[model samples]
Target: QKEVEQDPGPLSVPEGAIVSLNCTYSNSAFQYFMWYRQYSRKGPELLMYTYSSGNKEDGRFTAQVDKSSKYISLFIRDSQPSDSATYLCALELSGGGADGLTFGKGTHLIIQP
Candidate 1:
């Protein structure tokens, strides 16, 4: 099974709704988690990052990690049409050396106006 699993949700929601995205992983060695947002035809940019188990929030975005359950989540508050994009979850393994992050297949989201 893939180390990380995320629903590639073509999730649609009305504007101003709260949107939630999730990812789960089987690797206990992963200590860092990140969420990236990618707009159509553009590269992803990091939206949130957390180390180990905890919650981090920035503006309308929030990220949570649970090492015990090997699960992570991203919540977008007040969803907007400008928020339509692909969201990716990434993990950083312990002692990974120079290896880059392992990313989940992106979940596409659309916010209706």
Candidate 2:
């Protein structure tokens, strides 16, 4: 079973709003992070990935991690309607394997125009 917690929200926001998505995990071994964006009926597309406690930026998206607090966050700047989708937070142990990968239930987001 997954051990991550994320608010399963149909979180609504107007276009151009700044959106913040977060997740928390209890496992301290998790060192690799991934944030995915899933459209209505498509597979999740990896939005961000990181391996340390800091912030990583990609265009309008930012992914952050704080190991001490076991916290993960994804920030979307200048949010647009096309950003309406579900966001999934995933974590993995330090090794390069799939066995330790875990994911949160995901938060549904709606960017209203």
Top candidate by lDDT: 1
Across 33-85, the per-residue lDDT of candidate 1 in tens digits comes to 99999998998999998886888999999999999999999999999999999
Residue 9 of model 2, lDDT score:
99
Give candidate 2's whole-model lDDT: 0.92
**What TM-score goes with each of the models?**
0.94, 0.94
Q: Which portions of model 2 miss their true places by more than 4 Å?
A: 98-100
For model 2, residues 16-105, the per-residue Cα lDDT tens digits are: 999999999998888899999999899989999899999999999999999999999999999999999999998888756756568899
TM-score of 2: 0.94
Off by over 4 Å in 1: 95-97
Judge candidate 1 at residue 77 and give its lDDT: 98
> Model 2 misses residue 18 by how many Å?
0.5
Q: In model 2, where is the ten-residue run with the lowest total lDDT? A: 93-102
